[model samples]
Target: MKIAILGDSLVAISTAHSLLDQETDAEVHLFTERPEIGLMNEGPGIFEKWPPCPNHWISDLKSQEPSEGSNSVRRSWFEKAIAIALSERGCIIHLRTRCTDVSSVHVEVKGAGRIGSGRIPFDIVSDMRSVSETSTEWSGGVCITGGEPKLEITGNRSDGTTELWWSGPRKDTGSWLQEMKWIGEDPRESLTSEIKVGIEIARTLVDTIIQKSPGHKIE
Candidate 1:
């Protein structure tokens, strides 16, 4: 199986790729904006603590880095093509982004005659109580954090394919979101435990794709 994991950072893509590698004969390629793909962080608990790439890595390897660096990050042709073919089977893990842009909202009536809302953060239309259904449509892919903003890719559903990604509000916004950072792990250990877990996850996802589409090679 040929598998592609697209994300904002190396750790996420690695995690997704590793998961597939564990369960299948799939060849996993990781695409990220970080310059240091396949570069090892020689320290303790590096996998558990995914740290931001060092400044030197970014300056030197900027060109080869995943387009995720600039707005070009959104232009993930590999990820998009594979995601289209796999549809829901393909997964994208958004980093330091927001989920609002990727999903839809629905209003539900709760008890006590109260009106409640649900959030659709991922490809699936997960219901969310949107702040403003008409105003905050999330059509514009803008990541908001601490009043700092950046342009991002908005999710679109067409022709029965769903692009998979994730994000959340700012830290101050008090929403539970996954945050990526770096830590140290024993480089001499040869193979850290987290890498093993990541490979397993990637392999499992490959199996799912294969089972769903037996005619196609889901690598």
Candidate 2:
């Protein structure tokens, strides 16, 4: 089966990661407009006594040589690690690629770095992009305490400083929201739940895609 995972957030990263762990032979393609991940201001547990990123896809986040301010790991570095790992795992990673149009069977993209602009075909096309309507934009930290991604919430934090990705089915066919980052009244408290919720939703979204895939047999 040819599967396409779209988006540029942790959920998208986790989806591609989990899809591969299924051990199926489906050809997986991941596309994002970001020239690279972690370019945004992602917070961290990078300096915590226990550094995270040890589970699945996030585990691919490698610890590079300690830099001048080795206090906390940069989200840019952390995210890039996962992308590299996904590429090594046989996922056709397309950076600087943006999907102009999407349907149930294919995605029209203008891509670079690894893919030229073209319409890519797929047996199943999963839209992981955050298409929800929200005015909130957040810059938060991320950690890899260890577990798969999932989602069970549908709203944002109280402060409006952050917005959590709603993994629920999007009313529109062109988009589905599934990102993981935010801050609330107590940013720390909200952060913890955000990761948990993010993981759950990402897992649910991808699992649904895999089960519905034409060639994959779900037992």
Candidate 3:
């Protein structure tokens, strides 16, 4: 079974991390736009590059100005959240994760341009459940291992699409929710719930895999 996931750094990393944790015999690959920084591990070789290329660009970026500051940190978190959202969509097309008869998947990430590409052969592909975003009404902050994420919710006139926006030195300003809509209830609340649902669905899938795999530790 071969699966391909093409998306942002967060989604790529999370998928890779989760699958790696599973430790299944199946082969897994991670795809991301920022693969240079995403896959580049400079462990123990930071001194070799000296001032130019140091180890842990993600860590270093987090410690700097906008990423390190209070408000900006929240912005950073949301930005990453948006990236992961893309992966949520990509996983579904990979394979029929809902059933056991299906095996292997090919996931692909499509956006402004291709940042990275890879393949993950597996017994099943995870499905994307939901997506969430914080609005001015949520009134809170998020803490991340690297930095916090910023969120901005906007209402669109065309289709009344509510989008989360964020900008910073190292952050990208864009709608994290992607194609999702904000119609009936409060946009922020709706998005937040959606994200929770998505996470829950992923969790359920993991449980199902574990139950069937028995001895295999599926992350």
Which one is best on lDDT? 2
TM per prediction = 0.27, 0.59, 0.32
The alpha-carbon deviation from the true structure for residue 165 of candidate 1, after best TM-score superposition, in angstroms, is 34
Q: Rank the candidates by TM-score, best first.
A: 2, 3, 1
lDDT of 2 by residue, 1-219 (tens): 677888766556666766676635768888888777665644332332223333445444334433443434344555676767778789888888989999989999997765588888887787878753454434332223222123322222112222223322322322222233542333233323334444565466567766776798866
Question: Candidate 2: which stretches are off by over 4 Å?
Answer: 44-72, 131-219
Better of 2 and 3 by lDDT: 2
Regions more than 4 Å wrong, model 1: 7-29, 38-42, 45-191, 214-219
| Residue lDDT tens for model 3, 15-98 | 433443343333443333342322231101001111211122123333322321122222233334333433443323222111
Q: How far is candidate 1 from the true structure (C-alpha RMSD, Å)?
A: 18.1
What's model 1's lDDT at 66? 35
Candidate 1 least-lDDT 10 residues: 42-51
Task: Report the lDDT tens digits of candidate 1 across residue range 26-101.
Answer: 4433323333323322111111221122221122232323332122121233223222322223433222223223
Candidate 2, position 95, lDDT: 83
